[model samples]
Target: MPLLNSPRRMSHSLRALAWLLRYPDDEMRAALPALSEALHDERALIAGRLVELDDLIDRLAHAPALRAESDYVELFDRGRRTALHLFEHVHGDSRERGQAMVDLAQTYERAGLLLAPGELPDYLPVVLEFASTQPQAEAREFLRETAHIVRALFTALLERRSAYASVAAAVLDLAGERCDKVTLPEEPSLDESWAEPEAFGGCSTQGQSRPGQPQPIRVVRPQPAATRSAA
Candidate 1:
């Protein structure tokens, strides 16, 4: 089933940016025209940056389906450097990352941005979805705070000459941050060497509360006490 990107947030540009970074399944490919329009309509990105994004969109839209999907997996899922789970860059697999995930989820919930089941709060795409719900300046500030991780990802993508780097560049532009190159220390790909101590639970957000539909509140008055006494 296609991921339900049910209407929740308001910022079209940020939402479009998030979708661009998502796995380009058939549904995502179909949205290419709308995503492109959103990018241009919002005017959040510069003309040069827009051109760069267009390059990525073209590849995704026209490339062989398997090649596009496989390439996306190869580039992002294979390594931590390009991982879309943002907290990994900051907290790695440490305990602090768990706390960060919970805090971030709470932030999203407070703003009425409920995550789909199994969605991680720290996932960059989900973060953008939350940001999309906020006021423009507030959303930019949120992005700005994570600028370092994003810039690093951008640098890594640029170094690889990946077209997806444009999406990252556009994120920095939206955040009003400069993408300075950084030499990230080399890390082995998971396929090459899996990390020790696999995660016991899932994402930290697994601990976050999931409130369901409201239930009726029964009000039993003094009649209950009288009935009990009679019994």
Candidate 2:
């Protein structure tokens, strides 16, 4: 069967996943109803994965705000394995990673989407947000390019038995791919990795404009002053 590729539907899926991946502050909890509504219209495309995410969101909505935030930090921020920055898997502090980041930021700019200061282009949510702006076929092709990264994240989350794994699974589903089991490297100690200054070294500021630094503005060069209309 052909895969689901509704641009509007996929956008909702991406938005929901983006919200879910962020730190679950009170704002996130409060937005659960609207988020739920966004997904409700796309149930058929998402299949059971929608239920899985809705259930997870339901729990987050009812849980104490602080507990929800703590769990998010514990699962995503405390470890590198489940990190949502896609290039971390492929580039890992290499110079190539920096180039890839620049390329992706340029891609977004070409689409007229400017990222906020301090945002990383490889961050899954940001990528999804970019995909959400594309046409259906274009979005799917864009997503397929990163499908492997999503698969890897799904594997790590499943191993940890995290509910957030469902969010990753949903991403694969939207990309029209199945999650495959893969052997992942041993995870380093969270404390050690966090303590290292180089942990986020390469391409760390790829999409960010530093505070007080002039943000790169996109300018369109004026067309050669309209060919002189010599009467």
Give per-model TM-scores. Answer: 0.78, 0.79
User: Which residue pairs clash within candidate 1?
Assistant: none
What lDDT score is found at residue 96 in candidate 1?
83
Cα TM-score of candidate 2:
0.79
Off by over 4 Å in 2: 1-8, 191-231
> Model 2: per-residue lDDT, tens digit, 77-142?
767678888998877765788999999999999999999999999999999888878876788789
Question: How displaced is residue 143 in candidate 1, in Å?
Answer: 0.7
CA displacement after TM-score superposition, residue 23 of candidate 2 (Å)? 1.1
The clash numbers for all candidates, in the given order, read 0, 0
User: How much lDDT does each candidate structure score?
Assistant: 0.81, 0.79
